[model samples]
Target chain A: MSAMTHEEVRELLAAHVMELLLPEERASVVAHLAGCAECAREVESLRATSAELALAAPDRSFDARRCNGVRSRLLARTAADRDARARLAAGQLPEREPLSLRPPHATAPESAGGWRTASMVLAASVAGLILFGGSILVQSRRELAQARESESQRQRLIAGLIGPGVRLIELAPTERRPGSARMFWNQTLGAWTFLAYDLAIPAEGRTYQIWLITPDDRRISAGIFTPSADGNAIATTTYALAADSLTAVAVTEEPAGGVDAPSGDIVLLGAAR
Target chain B: MIADVRSPDDADALVTRVAGGDEHALGVLYDRWSPLVFSVCVHILGDDDEAEEAVEETFWQAWRQAERYDVTRGAVATWLTTIARSRALDRLRASRRRQEETMSHLSETKRAAVDATTRRGDDPARSAEVAERRVLVRQALLALPLEQREVLELAYFRGLSQTEIAEHTGQPLGTVKTRVRLAMEKLRDRLGILRERDA
Candidate 1:
């Protein structure tokens, strides 16, 4: 489209701020404002005035209970979003997905074999004499199961770190806090492996929350963790987002369970390449 | 919980804290501004439930984007009302689209009448400061010429484009655009003085 003349663009500023312009016209106005400081300033002034028009709406009181309900629900939603992100970061898949870390081939056959072995043992043992052995077997099986799960988590973390499309984001210490952190985002696998070092432990009832900053500057909670006594921490989780969605990563000190949104001092921040 | 209303500086400080991830500051900002935001939503959406949802979305966006707010450009109230209006308008347009699809046979006049039926009752229990601000804005709007005021209201409250406003009011599109500009300029001049006095 041909560019609007300066006088024509000035006439559109009022409608521009009110969002009454057509898409093409709005685009023209935006294009003009980028090069014309005077028009931009006028638009800002008009926008402020237009916002006041909202105050002219009839004054009405909401039921206090209902108003409070909205507040409670909103805050709760934020906290829930944080928790969900924390869960994702922790590698706890959502309920709809399978949660077992064990390979598909290892699960059913292993359980079936265990049952078969238990039946054989039951047949071979004198009932009262087998009690002690049964307890020992159970204890051994539990330990083995835990070891298997730990190894699986380790393998997954390693896989995420070395996966294709993995990018490293280094977070430098914010002025208010001293800490350095790095995040390995595996775009292809939707996994995040975050490691932080040289950080002071938070105060009682406080933890550090990690955030993923999107291109539009929205901060999405990644997860929350407390560092070890020596100020080192690692967290791993899988969240499938578009490859180019994240623009940066940050860490902030938040209350122990984490709030819905970031509301603490930024401890570390790094822009994504 | 309802707290005593604070000065604009305090409001700005709350926004600053909110930018730093301060939940308490967000809560305080909500307590202070939800009424005005709700009032705008209710006026546009005309349903308590939807207006309440809009209010929630407005503050949620505020909490998420507080860092983007530039205090040199506008007050917190203006920043919030802008968000509130945008969200409410989104819902309004969505619902209108749905209504148009399902109620396509309804006459335009009947639909307009239905739109006008959303009752706007005054609440006498509002805070004095909020009540005063409302009166000032209303007075500024009332001072505009009727034709100019009509176009502004059509655009602001109805979310109409200039072409749409012209179609709705049966005036030339240029005339509608000129009226919108004149009306907004007058409001800026009138409310600009009030803002300076408050500052």
Candidate 2:
């Protein structure tokens, strides 16, 4: 085989380190390194160094407060979503509940209980406790499991979202505005997730509106948002992109009765490319 | 009776559960390693708030893609750390001016797990040799150029694929390959003699 140039060898160095060499390339590099003491030595040191860093990398958890905060926020939002869905189904007002509160369990009224015999009461209490405790345990385990699965999903998506030249724009906080929006827009994907961090939800008659700016700088109505319990405005459906036409995603105040145009001013912007 | 559980098996089980569209499992998985993963980010980024957000965002992503885990490759810590590192690095790369500077800071702040292993000097000569070699490895790593050290870490430590590495680095595919090769060659040359001498 002809002698490899320094550049050729250098190029091969990376592939070899990764063990990415095709069968022929792997063989050639292996063979060359065996006889080429200088090259062979370099590969060893590099591998050693990589191993060191990886091993040395501190594998500690982030701030407990931050993690707990996320869980609390998610839990609050999920509960609100459940309640809203329930209220929507019941045709009743969307009753908001705090973390310290829970929905009243369905059970017979107290009059039905007082007339019952002592045995019946004992049996009923036992059964009720069993049912309640079992349900809570199952639900909590289920919820915890859901959190784990969500974490995994987040990891993969974040991996995909991350690439060369990808830009992340964090929207400034919307001060005291209940119908506000926050954003994480990726110009590469031309996609954004409009989140309601802490918005005082609009009345049942009113809703939040999201607008997207076209590449030519014209504003396009994208979608509408409603804050879940905990006032989190989560986008139900992801917005589609139009090449680089996306400039920014803005949320405006609209009438309790919805409108075709400017219900309010721009609440948040991602400044999409 | 089953002994104490492990993170790896839980990770595997969590992946299976997630594949079935169970969100609770995702949370459990996040709780187990979010700290370790976040620490990796903070270590790489050297900022608490940024690291915290990165971890939160990472779990949000994990919820959607847990089914992709393949257990035969490596440990869960390795896989998650790889992801965390990638995210942290992406943030670092986005702030171009901070890249070169953050690295030196990393080097300064960095500490090797030199004596972490339980082996002792009184052990067999081979064990001693292995321990010594490991220490040398750590030393050799701190000596590499920032680029090579990083690519090397992501590949061997985190087990990222070449294409993924290329995508993460944002360099042209060919250029990435070339840079890895050059880096390996340099590292190989440095360690070749030590390895041979030890052998």
Write the residue-wise lDDT of candidate 2 on B19-134 in tens digits: 66565666666666665566567656667766765665565445445567555433454456556666776675566455444445433432212222211232111223333443
TM-score of chain A of each: 0.47, 0.36
Off by over 4 Å in 1: A84-273, B1-7, B101-130, B193-199
Q: Global CA lDDT of candidate 2, please? A: 0.48
Q: Please give the CA lDDT of all the candidate structures.
A: 0.68, 0.48
Instruction: Determine which window of 10 residues in candidate 2 chain A has minimal summed lDDT.
Output: A116-125
Candidate 2, A163-244: lDDT as tens digits = 2323444454345443434454433333344445566666767766666655555555545655555555434222334446
User: Candidate 2: where are CA atoms >4 Å away?
Assistant: A1-55, A59-61, A72-273, B1-7, B97-199
Docking quality (DockQ) of candidate 2: 0.15
| Residue pairs that clash (backbone atoms under 3 angstroms), model 1 | A78-A260, A79-A260, A89-A237, A262-B21, A263-B21, A263-B22
| DockQ for all models | 0.36, 0.15
TM-score of 2: 0.37
State candidate 1's TM-score: 0.55
